[model samples]
Target: MPSSTSTSVSSFSHHFYTLLLLSVLLVAFFPGAFHYLSSLPFAYLSAASSPSSTHQPSSDQGPTTTATNTMSWFQKQFSLPPRSRGSYLVTDHVASAVPEIAQYKVGLLNLFVQHTSCALSLNENWDDDVRADMSDALDRIAPEAGPKGQELYRHSAEGADDMPAHIKSALIGASITIPIKDGKLATGTWQGIWYLEFRQVKHTRKVVATIQGEKA
Candidate 1:
């Protein structure tokens, strides 16, 4: 009986040593795999305690609502009616041409004339006299003819108004920026956009309107 028990004990010890040797060989051959396996529990704990994970909505709370994109940009080109030399109130014309301006809640409206002989400005809206006076004032500033009724400039290739038109356009600028609020232009009660045409003959003009803001 004693001999049989000793044989069984020796067999169990040999099997245990074989298993330990195999495990050691596997670890030596695949150190990176063993390391990754050993670090899995620690990585999981760190991720669970991270700020991003803390902010995540609970699964029991159902699907989360996505946020709306606030920043938006819109641009469109439109044509203005033909006009002779003058400063005309074009607020209505711009609004009519770019109806997309009404989609913004708070933003900026930029109106850019595509012509060099015309300018865009902000000025008085009410009286027709203001427009007339502005035209006369610009004519005095940059006249088509000299004091003796002679050609004053050399850049009259287009017409007598060519050089003077360019000068006036430069002085007044070809673009105007206005604030928009509640999907409407926020100009002052007396303020309006002005389109200054420097040509003697009537000519149609093109304008590019750009809007940047949050959508309503």
Candidate 2:
């Protein structure tokens, strides 16, 4: 029979080997466990690592952390239905096509008109006369060629009104930016978007709508 001292020594050695094997297995299977546990919230690993720690936050003062998504970016392209050679109020129309913009709590919504003969702008929303006035003003600035016997432009490959259309597009601009808030456009009470159609004939237009911001 083994002596008491020898038996106790053997038992101690077996326990030590068992513990060492367990530790090795843990490290082998979970190489990053230490880092992951360390990075966890204090309360997560504190109970086992620090039983007497008084730095624990109370129930009421529990982690005030909130889950938030990382800064995001999204873009989409949509077509603007064909319209005649006149400035038209299309604020709601564009927004309707891009429901994703309404999902954003705050961000900048951008509209880029791809056609050179058509452009985008911001102007009065109410009163139809504002659109008429803008159309008349642009006409005066870059009137369609003909009738008056004025062939002032050289690029007539498209048509008599084509060159003036390009000029008008340049004047109005090809894109516009609007602030989005509360899942809707933050346009002024009287502000609206305008798609300036410089071409005499109607043609389908494509508008690239890009929105970036936090979701509500």
Best candidate (score: lDDT): 1
Give the poorly placed runs of model 2, Cα more than 4 Å off: 1-69, 146-148
Q: Report the CA-based lDDT of candidate 1 relative to the real structure.
A: 0.91
Which prediction has the highest TM-score against the true structure?
1
lDDT by residue (tens digit), candidate 2, 54-77: 465679986844465765577888
What digit string (tens of lDDT, one per residue) describes model 1 on residues 131-210?
99999999999998989999888788898999999999999999999999998999999999999999989999999899
Kindly report which residue pairs in candidate 1 clash with one another.
Answer: none
Provide the lowest-lDDT 10-residue window in model 1: 49-58
Clashes of each: 0, 0
Which 10 successive residues of model 2 have the least lDDT summed?
64-73
Error of 1 at 191 (Å): 0.7
Give candidate 1 misplaced runs (Cα > 4 Å). 1-50, 53-68
Q: Candidate 1: deviation at residue 97, Å? A: 1.2
- Alpha-carbon local distance difference test for all models: 0.91, 0.85
